[model samples]
Target: MSERLTLPIGPQHPLLKEPIHFRFTLDGETIVDADIRMGYNHRGIEKAAEERTYIQDLYMIERICGICSHTHATNFVQAVEKILNVEVPPRAKFLRTVVGELERIHSHLLWLGVAGHEIGFDTLFMVSWRDREIVMDLLEIITGNRVNYGMNTFGGVRKDMNQEEIDETLKGIKILEERTLYYEKVAREESTFIARVSGVGYLPKDIAIAYCAVGPTARGSGVNYDVRRDFPYAAYDQIPFQVITSERGDVLGRTLVRVGEIFESVKIIKYALKNLPEGPITARVPRKVPQGEATSRYEAPRGECIHYVRANGSEKPDRVKVRAPTMANLMSIRHCLLNQQVADIPIIIAAIDPCLSCTDRLILLKQAGEKEGEILTWEELRRRSIAKKPL
Candidate 1:
């Protein structure tokens, strides 16, 4: 038997893009076991929502993920609106879908570029990011912001996408579609890229399911689950697009899945623009929410992001719990990293494109010096939040 030694890859490491820490037990170059710690930057947005008004919480949620800001913002509001039984208009639905899909494209391109960079394929990284500017410009034009579009509001979208904007967006989509096709070819045919990624991070189908992986991570492993197609949020049901998947269950497979999904996103964007209807973009919403709790699910670029909001007939929510896709996908990354080479760590972790920001939360708490800090579950936390007391 080989003696193994433990190594830390985070808290601060080259492999870590965020502040997540990973402890790996390795036998020589191969990882034998792995554990991850995610709370380094815990911001407690869920608990913070209780202290802020419903409108204020929307902005807080949108900041959860810069890449998938639309997803977080939309899902949070969808849950609030559900508690109020407010239905989103068809036009607003399509507009949200347009921005949402555009976000997906931008996110995937960013991931692809980062992945290429991780594998030392800087040429591919440079090209992918250069093309990503098309989507960035389009998002700015549509939402008046680049990173956090702030398109989503309480009942609908804030941005009223005009005909000129639609035309320009369509043109941008066409350009991205062609670029994706080229990337898809390069990802598959380029020997250098394949040599670095193929079979490097393998997550079998059963293992992926057992880990509760979501989004591209699970889809890459042949798990057929996508919140956009399954739950049908934001005119997704009206849009016609296939759920892109891969059977390879490796880093390369996830890459291909994301690239393919971009093409699908383009199709949805074009269709939504062609069929856009005339109506008010947002509905009037009440300031004080009725007492209710609802869960919202949206397929973000990374995976399914869920928001559970509980209102107590007040301006603020009693509890706003978020389950980002990266939380579920984190387990799969541990499994994928096991038995892999130490050098493969960064690329394997990057394959999931883990958003460590969404994994943590911002808590509303007073400083505890000699005072004992008690760990509270979501239920207990909800109680304190409802009472407007500090933990």
Candidate 2:
């Protein structure tokens, strides 16, 4: 009988730039069981939100994940708007949708680049990221910031798109749509991409539903539950776009779904921009909000980003809890990683589009001979590093 072996995949794996450790119990190359340890980058943003004013919390929430910054801010502001019973203007809602879709494009393209790099497709990675700059440029032209758009406010948005900027964005989207089609074809027909992705790290439909996976992770498994469709926020109801889904439930399925979504986002953005309403972008919201609690959900780039906020009739909130999409999808890792070879781990994990900063805080834990030991702080790790006398 072959003996079982234990392997620690990461706290710092090449596949994941973020810090997450996966302990795998393997019989040969097949994983028999897995344990995931996160919280390596926990910044206590939720608890810190309670200490900051509503407006201040917007900036804090945006920092939750750099890729999904706009969605986080939008979700946070939507919660506050609901708590105050304030109705954002139609124009603001349209603008918010535009900005949110732009963020999605950037994030998905970034993921595609990362996934390509994981599979040794440096050319694809470079091309995907190069095309992604179009969306980033459009976002910058519209909101004046590349990553943190700073578009959302308590009641509405801070900026509006004039005719010239709108025209420029439309031109950019046209270019993006063509490039998206090209990438979609590559994802489908490229043998190398297919071999690495198809039928790899599958999260079956039943398991995905049971695990409550959100966004593309759920949709890729043929679950058509989009927050924008079911809940309709930020001019989604007024715009026309389809929720892309795939029944394959594999890494390839997730990749295709995200690729398809780029076009859907373009469709939504073009529609919203063409039919954008004219009005004051910013609405007057009181600095101190009334005592109330509200929850807001948005379809972020990775999946659903939910924000729960409780206002205590003060400038600062009483409590803020964020259920990021990655947090929900992490539950499915054990199921996906089991039976898959070690080499597939990076691509599989990347398929879920994890935001380690949102889900983990880096505190290194030491374990000795199957017995867990003390957790090391960053300062401790720094101090423990050996210094060379001379080189």
| Each model's Cα RMSD | 7.4, 4.6
Tens digits of per-residue lDDT for model 2, 161-226: 889999999999999999999999998898888987898998999999998899899999999899
lDDT of 1 by residue, 171-265 (tens): 99999998899999988898988888999899999999988999999999999999888999889988889999999999999999999999999
- Each model's number of backbone clashes? 6, 8
Q: Alpha-carbon error at 129 in model 1, in Å? A: 1.0
Give the Cα-based TM-score of candidate 2 against the true structure.
0.92
Worst 10 residues of 1 by lDDT: 361-370
Question: Clashes in candidate 1: how many?
Answer: 6
lDDT, residue 150, model 2: 89
